[model samples]
Target: MSSTLLEVTRAAHEEVERLERIIVKDLQNEPATNKDRLFQSHRVRNMIETIMSTTHKLVEIYEDKDSARKDEIAALGGQTATGTNVFSAFYDRLKEIREYHRRHPAARVVDANEEHEALLKEEPVIEFTGEEAFGKYLDMHELYNQFINSKFGVPIEYSAYLDVFSQPHSIPRKLKLTRQYREYMENLLEHLIYFFQRTEPLQDLDRIFSKVTAEFEEQWENDNVQGWEKDVKESGQLPPQHTVIDLDYYSTVEELMEVGPDKLKEALVALGLKSGGTLQQRAERLFLTKDTPLEKLDKKHFAKRSHGSEQNGGAPALKEVDNSKEIALMEAKMKKLCDLLSETIVQTKENVVKKQALTYDEMEAEREEEEMQADTESDDEEQQIYNPLKLPMGWDGKPIPYWLYKLHGLGQEFKCEICGNYSYWGRRAFERHFKEWRHQHGMRCLGIPNTKNFNEITSIEEAKELWKKIQERQGLNKWRPDLEEEYEDREGNIYNKKTYTDLQRQGLI
Candidate 1:
């Protein structure tokens, strides 16, 4: 499509030049009538030149407008047509000009009427030397630099190589997406090299060139195979094969493509592989037979004959038996073995019978004995009921029956210092009473510190009152401090060697 358009554009230029030649010829053939004729000839030449220049300029502008329209459409998130107000204004102006011309008729004079004027005004001609033209193109070149910098994060000079050397001046028409885009990629390589020389890590530029060239070729071909614009519109993302690795891994073609043959070898070595044997070979050697080196048979088959052998067809092998005198010896051994077996059988039977019978006998004996013991205990308890000992301490220090003492395990020997007769229970009961009022008062009267008292508690209220008094008098607070600290310390020391040794010796620590 572009080639055809270029051909048409070239033909149009030729036709315009041909038409200019015909007009110049017609003007030159006119009768030369002194000053007027000379002036008319000059004007005709000027008009022809003006028309040619203006026509070319208009073509350039329209082409640029078309390109800008496409760009605007693309930039506005891909609408099909550009929605530029300039196009509407141009259309309205074109209509007005055509209407004015149609309404106001002029004399039919060939290249002589001043009223039928040329649409173009004379433009200032900038006479550019080679350097200036190069500079003009360089303006485009710099844009290429900016483009490469923006798109691929490369600098302009580095991206200028292609423009400077590969194909100078005549930028490829295919890449001329727009006037900007045409120069943009054309000078990409050169500008890229410019920036890379200063900012780049050490690398062979030629290798980078080769890789990039290959990439460009690939991308170009891909765009051809799958239309670049269509692919972008159809897919929200770039295609899978279009992926480029980041800077860190973009060292070589292989690395960029992730075809890590060298790395695979290194990985195999890291996996403890030495020889270049295939995985299948390794697995076969590890899991399969190990007979002869060639056959690699298993060891289990050595003790048994192989199947389908005539001599050992159905059965493998049977043990050999002796005859005559050896048989008589075997008979004697059998008799001894049978006798031992009989003894073992008898012992097993006896063990089972004993196990079963012993539990039944024990249960029966325990029942009879428990009944006798219960009767005996009842007789003894009745005797003790009438012969109760006197309790020295009671709730009010009155004499109490010894039965409570027997059950409570507290008597005169267990009397609290604070409340002497009040202590008549176990250690826990004594400790409870110690935290009571009577026990506190008795200890104080006896010149013994209240701390020495125990078992004077007759009620929960008395225990609380004594505890509060002790806390106030002795500055003691926090119950079970000793027990708590002992527990914490012992728990902390459990992992110590001495603690472990003591635990092992005592079967507990």
Candidate 2:
């Protein structure tokens, strides 16, 4: 009985030693966060407590058995041995084991001073407050509203528009302008023009206004139009409409050149001229002489001019043409581009705000549901239950403490056969989790040392192959002088072979 008790105690001690080795190794190698260190410390403490309790019980049992045996020997007329108690040796061993643990504490369960230092090193989480979030949202909303109304001459209701924007599918659907509001504005413009025509003395006012409206409509059509109405109407099948440039306005080459390269290119391209060469080359080719007729210049003529220029080994020197009209046209185009860019920026900001508002709304709904569920649970006595292991939900509806996913192998896309088929979502997570404790444990269970490439192995066969290579390297290292040599000076400082050789050559050691 005494022998059996001793065996049990020894086995427990061995198990405790194994756990301690694992904990110490993890502490040395793993770059754990404060929370992770705390968890490891608690686990070690629990295991230690259980070992201590079991050893005490075993000692008690051994003492009782020893006492009974001594009594039986005395009753049988045999001289009772007065030597040292058998349980005393076990007690001494237990004390020594306890002392060893006391001297070498569990991983991250450091002395008070060390714990204080660790606490100081920990970073606090910064949470975004409701008031700050709402304030930012309101500011962005006002700016976006002002930009749209000022630029497009349309007013949007903030609350109503935000409701549509907050929908999860709204952004992908490309919800930009409201259809009813657009049609209303178009009709209003027409009504205003009619009213002005009846009230004013100008006879051709309506015709002038209609022409201006047509130009604006043409511009809108040519621009990259967003929203469902434009998409459903165009269907990406129709070719882009060309801008009609009345050639009658520009009677001379000088007047044509004043419109700038872009407008000049557009006019030439529309007129079926050869669309080759640089803007300057094309312009020079088309207007070779001041009296050259625009109708007379064709693709063949332009091609011939290009071939002639190439044969002559260089482009013909064209005269620099600059005018006030060209400068004015460039300025106008720049201003239009600026307006389009600003509108795009404003729309992008609006999308960001929509996303934020959607997240905020979802969080609020979740909070309310939790509160209601708590109330119902409180009303029921037997039915009320709590799960301490369940993690809290984040604002995005994911589990709080994101590392929990790694532990349970949840939300992962790839599974590794070597690590008990644990899943990893991305390459980063897969690589990072390989160095983690859970993965290392799996390797140990398979009787394989967790090498640098252990985490990278996807199958048991791969692990075995790597282990074989590692053993070969170890065997080679045993015979290698480079692996065995370590230099130490009189001050007991250790150095590698290269460093020691250099130091000795320099007489520094």
Candidate 3:
């Protein structure tokens, strides 16, 4: 569309030039002398012809200059009629600009206004030039970045960026968002891999980003997937990873009896065992599958068998399992593996569908269990939370170490009298609290403007006194022209304008 518009604009220029030439020719050939020949004088005709010729020359010159300009524009990639603003190269220029300035301390940085004025005067001036930060790399190569950005086609709107680059952690500019800019930190890291790929000098950085992003992906999976499996095992829903390490060893009746009742039931379900009764019954039910090695245990339940299952498919191979947790997490793992085997048994042996009715009591118990787990973790940090000052606990439900508390100046107390003697912990908090709701409310109650002058002044008396002094100063500084201006009498005695006026009216100087 822009190309079409540009072509039309070019053609319009040609048409206009052609029309102008035709109009000039018509005027010149119209003959200055009329049909009556009343103005047919040699000198007059010569004067009229000279004026028309000069006008024709001026028009030709304009056309030539315009053509030259068109060629220049075409050489630099023909002008696009659709361009609303200039595309600045931010990423390509900012680093170089900073480097140049840093290396050359004597180099003066010319601001935008100075550069504009110098250009207007056609004088040479060093101007700050940088390429605009356009996130084409993210929009193209990074899949997540591309996907998130595709949700909104508005890259920039209302004079603000509406894309991923406008997000909180955007490298270019981190400004308050006028619209929702949803994205994850890892996506930004992935996009940086290619962002630096374009920079020849930063090839090492390209490799670094690739390594970092890979590590991030692995860490995320470990945290989420493994954490979920651990939760399932803890809840007695599945057996732990290590216990399931050797499904064949636990197939015997003796091994089956070793697991607890709940685990035994779960094991029965996992091994495709459908029988249900006491703990011993569930165990005895699992013992029936002793001959069918863990490898072929599923064959009795299902007639069809895959070639791989018949060969190496005894169980799914786990990846990245930390086997070192075998001892400490044995009970959990035992329950986990048994539960998995139990599930396999029931699912394969029983055609009846299993249903789970929601248990509100169990949900409450689980919530309490999670809290208790956190409490247990806290206990590991210390036998008990010991703080004579009663410092606040961190998110982990344990008081922060004493050294850290002192480092943040949390040991020192600050009382804001204006805020009803509300206590604030640390200088930073004390400084910030002045602008917060409590302090603002206090200032409002005192009928004082929440100005910067009253920031450190917390006491009610001090604030009231300052307000009184401010009022007095303002009154003294108020515009009173009658008292401020002086009038000199004939005897050179000076009086205030108001008194002088009164005395003069009474004919007394």
Arrange candidates by TM-score, highest first: which order? 2, 3, 1
Evaluate all candidate structures by whole-model CA lDDT and list the values in order: 0.41, 0.49, 0.49
Error of 3 at 256 (Å): 99
Clashes per candidate (backbone, < 3 Å) = 31, 0, 28
In angstroms, the error of model 1 at 97 is: 28
Q: Predict model 3's lDDT versus the native.
A: 0.49
The runs of at least 3 residues in candidate 3 whose Cα sits more than 4 Å from the true structure, single-residue gaps closed, are 1-389, 479-509
TM-score of each: 0.17, 0.25, 0.20
Put the candidates in lDDT order, highest first: 2, 3, 1
lDDT of 3 by residue, 243-337 (tens): 22234667565676776777666555444355467777676656655444444454443223333443664442231133312211322232332
Evaluate candidate 3 by giving its C-alpha RMSD to the native, one decimal: 37.1
TM-score top scorer = 2
The candidate with the higher lDDT, 1 or 2, is: 2
